[model samples]
Target: MAKTRRVSEEIVCAAIRKRKKRTHVPEADAPKAGEPRSFVIRRGKYAPMLKDLEKDLRQMMMPNTAKELKESRKNVLKDFVQVAGPLGVTHFLMLSATQRAGYLHVAKTPRGPTLTLRVLEYSLMRDVQSAQQRPRCPQTMWHGPPLVVLNNFTGSEHLKLAATTFQNLFPAINVATTKLSTCQRVLLLDHDRASGRIRLRQYSIVVQPSGVTKNLKALLGRRAVPDLGECKDVSEFLTRSGYGSESEGDDPDTTRVELAEDLGKGNQKARQSRIRLHEVGPRLEMELIKVQDGLCEGNVLFHAYIQKDPAEIAERKSKEDEREALRRQRRAEQEENVRKKESEAKRRRRPQDDARGAKRPRPEGRVPWG
Candidate 1:
């Protein structure tokens, strides 16, 4: 009996240890302090194109952003901004459209400095996939955020601000601890210096075994049993040039790299792997229209088309200040009026309250036995 009890206790302890190990979260996976979380939402009337673009943007900002956030025409920017504070949402990507064009607003939460970009052209994910012969979108591709890559953003002041805003939209990665497996996607923002336009491309990072023939890879890593009826022997099938021969025949020196860690199936550490970026949908060509001092409002810091002189800027600032002062005065007067109304109401109720508390006249009737 004692031996059985001891065995049971040991089993219990082992199970507890296993549970603890399973529950432990690595430091790299834990939410970092001041990490940016985002909300990609649409405002105003629904545009069919904008709806799909919003979905793509949400997918691009995976894990750290709300994917299924619902918005209606009745919902205003203030509604989202008000809730953003308590929920720790640090950025907002608001998509809206007019009859003329669509706009993407990237704004910092609870503060100023919003970047507005006009969408010149866009391609949905479905459209992109339709054009490709084989689109590589894995089920777990969006399990983590995409790595942001900025190109040619060093030209002007506005471009610098835009780049900063774009960078903060995703959480920062630590080079020392970040795993290669988690980097399944890439968000490339390429800016054209002459055209002043930005091209947004989303790609999946594909790592395949290097120095392996296409036929051999297919035989080893076949998802389903590939038809073997074409050849009498397996060697014949392996030696034959297949449909995707051009990809396999390319020089591997340019794209091949030594893997630092184990990534994906058969991509082991210290092994040579070919890294390829496959464009996975939702391309956008946009131009920075303006940068504003506030969320979707306030003084324009940069405008692509409009340039104001110093005197004009000064006059605009003075006018804004006067308008703000007037608004404050009106608010103060309204508060005073409300306070007076409350006081008058209290004064009127005071006598009635006192009368109720006072003793009624017991005089009319004769008193009796005590």
Candidate 2:
């Protein structure tokens, strides 16, 4: 046998390094002609305004920021409601940011890009000026045109920022104003009122500083009741007309009668009732029902009644019953047919099986061959 020579580790490593050094590898270079290169394209002008908008968006998306925004909006709406309540403005329609954006209309004007905002104008029957004599009971009709609000938002420092933005995007449809003022004070008002068209009322908003104590002289003095229970408080706001408990003052004859003996007793499930005396307070007592010249009693505006003939209903019921009975009868007949077919198949197969068994040859007796 020839003696095999064992290669040393250093010799093998040197041979691998020599081979690697001699090997030719390709290099990664820039793309040549006709080669595709990745590139990005951006639309619109990318300026400081875009940066500011992006920054505001990021701030709005931050944690707790969205909640704070919602709370702020609620407070703003509540303030509006409070201010409008005394102004005889009972209804309000608040549009969301998306809705406001959808209604935005842009038109090129000589001055610049003018913003027109369309807002609902509420006109009460009382506000309508008629030449005819007022009836004893006037029928209050509520209908108003869509108010048109115009603004440039150039110098909107004193104006409400949100309202200014809203008006810029969503303008009113109709132009109506109580009086004529300067062009700056009114919407679309020009030097020549006769020749000027598209003139509308300029929208103005004033947010009063909260927490300012009103003058005591302006308000009437009244006694204060610390506890709500001590005062007889009743609300006219109820789900149904005759649902709420009658006020003791409204109906002095109204009385509470307990049907169960357990009632008014100190039982676990008993309802406790007591004849208590309390004074009415101004704060707790609210007059929900208003009395106005055109106002009417009752809150129901529209009612619908659906009537059906008894004979038709009875016919429909009878048809349904007949359908159900027919379905049951059909199901029973199908089951009986299936059972009969199975029995007939079994009877026919039994005789054939017996004949086949008889035809089979019996095993011959084995003959022993000694």
Relative to the true structure, candidate 2 reaches a TM of 0.18
Task: List, residue by residue over 29-53, the lDDT tens digit for candidate 1.
Answer: 4445688888999876645558888
Q: What is the lDDT of residue 54 in candidate 1?
A: 91
Candidate 2 Cα deviation (angstroms), residue 267: 40
Instruction: For candidate 2, list the clashing residue pairs, or say none.
Output: 104-169, 116-171, 117-170, 117-171, 117-172, 118-171, 118-172, 119-172, 187-202
- Model 2 over residues 237-350: C-alpha lDDT tens digits? 222243333332331322222223332112112232222221110010111111111112122211123334778667866886898899999999999999999999999999
Of the candidates shown, which would achieve the greatest lDDT relative to the real structure? 1
lDDT, candidate 2, at 183: 12
Stretches > 4 Å off in candidate 2:
1-306, 359-370
lDDT of 1: 0.86
| Per-prediction TM-score | 0.77, 0.18
> In order, what lDDT does every prediction score?
0.86, 0.29
What local lDDT score does residue 141 receive in model 2, on the 0 to 100 scale? 9
List the lowest-lDDT window of 10 residues for candidate 2: 279-288
